[model samples]
Target: MSGVQDQLEIKFRLTDGSDIGPKSFPAATSVATLKESILAQWPKEKVSGPMTVKDVKLISAGKILENNRTVGECRSPLCDIPGGVTTMHVVVQPPALEKGIGIVQDIAQTI
Candidate 1:
């Protein structure tokens, strides 16, 4: 156990008030890694479109974490991070819908 550190447990809070989990990851894990894990374990019933890392944003301690940054980099910013499970908010921004769909609405209103 030369340089071994305790794993960090993170739980995600979604927009609908649903939570993902307190998944464990090495302290050195990157934000990108966390996003990938979420996509892999995302509830099918909740998501419909492609769930990519770009669609996921992780916020902790009121700060939006950088994808390239490590979880350890964020540890100090959060209060009692090591003392208990670190809670982060996961925001999934819906993709913009196509513009053509609006044409139907315009035609209906004209009639």
Candidate 2:
């Protein structure tokens, strides 16, 4: 016999100042799973290492997102879009650029 399934709606904020919202999926999903789904939508962004839904902030009605809580760790599966949801927030931190005197010297020689 088939049983009713619980669904959840997730929203993401991109660094580009855009917002993705109203993404619905099955409940009881893990943070890793949700990250995968988000990546599918935004292939340009890479999410690795310590970055995760924990960095995502929920700005909507019926719920309040806490600084300590992450989307992956939240008990509420359903996310509502009340307002002020900016897709501009980045889920992953960008990699740092390498620094060295050799690189600058090479550029100077080329000039």
Candidate 3:
């Protein structure tokens, strides 16, 4: 069988606190690519650039989320407990929305 056929299925959560269904991807998928996929799912919501993944935390089953570490960097000892490789939790911080110039002008006029 091909490597892709043996790839594992995992679930990822969006920054908006939404649960994304399990997806099949190669084990070699980078944390950065995962972040991009999450953002793409929610096009309407504002999301920070690549750097935002630095703040994401991957939570495994039973294990609590403590420090901020990307899945790629998280390994044994830190989160290598048994039965911890299947499920993962990612914390994504949505991008901030700025008021339009016209809106600001209108508010200023009202003041």
TM-score of each: 0.75, 0.42, 0.44
Candidate 1's residue-wise lDDT over 1-111, tens digit each?
Answer: 524345777888877888889777888999999999888888889755336898788998888999999988877653644447888888876545324457777888999
- Report the CA-based lDDT of candidate 3 relative to the real structure: 0.53
Off by over 4 Å in 1: 1-5, 48-50, 97-111
- Tens digit of lDDT per residue, candidate 2, span 1-111? 112234555566655566556475554555555555555566445444323444343442335445554453454324433332222133453333123566877899999
TM-score of 3: 0.44
Q: Give the whole-model CA lDDT for all candidates, comma-separated.
A: 0.78, 0.47, 0.53
Clashing pairs in 1: none
In candidate 3, list every pair of residues with a backbone clash. 46-95
lDDT of 3 by residue, 1-111 (tens): 666433555676554566665676564566566656654554454445334554454565545444433443433355443333355666543333224666888899999
Worst 10 residues of 3 by lDDT: 76-85
Top-lDDT candidate index? 1
- lDDT value, residue 46 of candidate 2: 43
Ranking by TM-score: 1, 3, 2
TM-score of 1: 0.75
Better of 2 and 3 by lDDT: 3
